[model samples]
Target: MRETVYIFLKAPVAGRVKTRLGAVVGMGRAAALFRIMTDWTIAEAQKGSWETVLAVDPPAAAHKRARFWPPRFRRVAQGPGDLGARMARIFRTAPPGPVVIIGADAPGLRARHLREAFKRLRGADAVFGPAADGGFWLIGLARRRAAPDLFDSVRWSSEHTLADTLKTLPESFDVRMLETLRDVDEAADLETAMFRGRR
Candidate 1:
């Protein structure tokens, strides 16, 4: 079986996406920025040697033929749940072989990170790409064994997000950490990403 990478994204609807950043940059601008980031993310994922999927939110977005995302890639509904529940569903349902999932909010994410995650998964039971914000930008599982409680009791957006997730894993699990990246969830984060791009 081939490896897979799922990009979790919400429909690029004004006021519905990136509400935190939207509050600072206006809803329209926030939504537009989301589109650009999603586009860049998809392009980078395509350069990898794995199956690329768009895990769309709102559930209904899965069936829409016309949307902001490109039509070439496969899509799956994120279903109804908190972030952890939705991600666990993908892990449980992905095809045989290692599975990696990432969010669109991290603009600094590149194909190299995806490549590294899959590479790390080969030796470790799991791999995590930590974000500057206390949360994680990427998570991958080798699926060599069961992991039904991997996301249990995780604090979604707080600073303890990654720490709580690590606690949920069994003691025997050998987890690898990837380079820390910044997720564009606030105006300041966006500014930093843009500034880095100009360098």
Candidate 2:
């Protein structure tokens, strides 16, 4: 079965995006950095066997397309409130198949990573690509679970994010683990990403 992959993206607005890295790299450079990474993510996910959707926020669809997205892919806004709320909103909208939600900042995320997630979802109820920082860069779900509790009562963006999410998953659900990857959240992480790429 074909899986629906949601690519959650923030508009590469200078000050609004990558603010944690902003102090070290400056917002101008932070946005530039995010732009490069987001493009890499989109291309990687587009490589094989899945349907792609770009879910963004501050909601003008066409404007998002013109700025960072390709003309062919569909787009949706993240919608009001926090990160969890926005992500839950889209999970509800995805069709009954495997639905994989991924963040925009993982420099190592690639087409094969996504393909493996979908493939693993065949036997698992959920699959997570745990980030070193304790959040997940990628999460995929099979149709049997209702994700309401999946995003609830947790810290968003903190080291506890993944731990909190694990608390909400149903024991009846099967989960698979994927290769861990790093998400670029600061200048140091950016340095690591560049260094790894050069290797």
Candidate 3:
């Protein structure tokens, strides 16, 4: 079975993407940063041996032949749902084998992190890379068995996001944790990156 990575992305349109970050730093700037991060993530993901798939938002974007994302890789619509519903769709529909999912918000993401997720999945039923802001940046499942309750009652963006998600998993499933990384969701989160010339 082949390992795969699904990248969740929204169309990098001003006021439409990165609204939180946009509220802090002009919408156009936020959109530009979003594009840069998306591009960087795609390049890093391609460095890994696993297949790369873009799970695009707005559904219609996936249908367009010439969209913001690269045409070389496969693209699929995220469909209608909240964050958890959309993600659950991928876990339930992905091909046999381990599957890892990530968002483009974490600028520190590297190919090594993805490789580590797959490695941990060799023994663990699920793996999560926690975000400093209480959400998660990466989630992977071994998929040896079905997990219908994995996202049940998940509080999307609250401080208990990870904790709530963990509660949904079965007690029998062994889970692994990765290092906590910061997501560029607010102005403060982007301050350090700006000083470091992230772009």
Candidate 4:
């Protein structure tokens, strides 16, 4: 089956990206870190077999002329809506096939993780790579069936995010869970990532 991976990203502008981390590390440094992480994520995710698309926020036109992104990959504006709404749109509009979406802040994301998510989708209706902080780092839909209202009532950015999203799915939905990964959100998360790297 054709597979597509969407990497959700915000333009690396000071005071806008990684604001939580920015509060602690200064906006300039935070934006810088976000840029590095986003670059790393795209590079690693591109290693997988699926087509990689950058689902950029602030709209495509804003960054269309920007030279930051690699030309080989496709770019699309995330358009207006909440996170769930935007994600649902992608699942609904993307070419017929499995679709996986991930945030760019997770430095631990690797090609193997994405490859495994696609493999799981072969049989499961959905797959989630749970995050250590109770949210999920990755979400994928097989698209064999109509996309379900899986993101409704989700308390985004809360510890209940993943659980709330799971609760929204139909009882009959076959869901698969992947290994938990860490996503940098605050100073503590950044520290954890740095420590892990030294190991």
Which one is best on TM-score?
Answer: 1
**lDDT tens per residue, model 4, 1-199:** 6899999888888998889999989999999889888888998898977999888888854357656677777888888989988898888888889999999888888899999999999999999999998999999999888647768988999899999999887888899999998899899998776346635
The C-alpha TM-scores of every prediction are: 0.97, 0.94, 0.96, 0.95
Local accuracy of candidate 2 as per-residue lDDT tens digits, 99-136: 89997899888789888998898888899999988899
Q: Which stretches of candidate 1 lie over 4 Å from their true place?
A: none
Q: Assess candidate 3 and give its lDDT.
A: 0.90
Q: What is the C-alpha RMSD of each candidate to the true structure, in Å?
A: 1.1, 1.5, 1.4, 1.6
| lDDT (Cα, 0-100) at 174 in candidate 2 | 84
Quick one: ranking by lDDT, best first? 3, 1, 4, 2
What is the lDDT of every predicted structure here? 0.90, 0.84, 0.90, 0.87
Can you tell me which runs of candidate 3 are displaced by over 4 Å?
193-199
In candidate 2, how many clashes are counted?
1
How well is each residue in 1-199 modelled by candidate 1, as lDDT tens digits?
A: 7999999999999999989999998999999999988888998899977999999988888888867688888999999889999999998899999999998888888899999999999999999999888899999999998886888989888899999999888889999999998988889997776447635
How many clashes in candidate 1?
A: 0
- Candidate 3 lDDT over 1-199, as tens digits, reads 9999999999999999888889988999999999988998899999978999999988998988866988998999988888999999999898899999999988888899999999999999999999987889999999997787878889898889999999988889999999988888888988663325454
lDDT of 4 at 124: 96
Clashing pairs in 2: 125-174
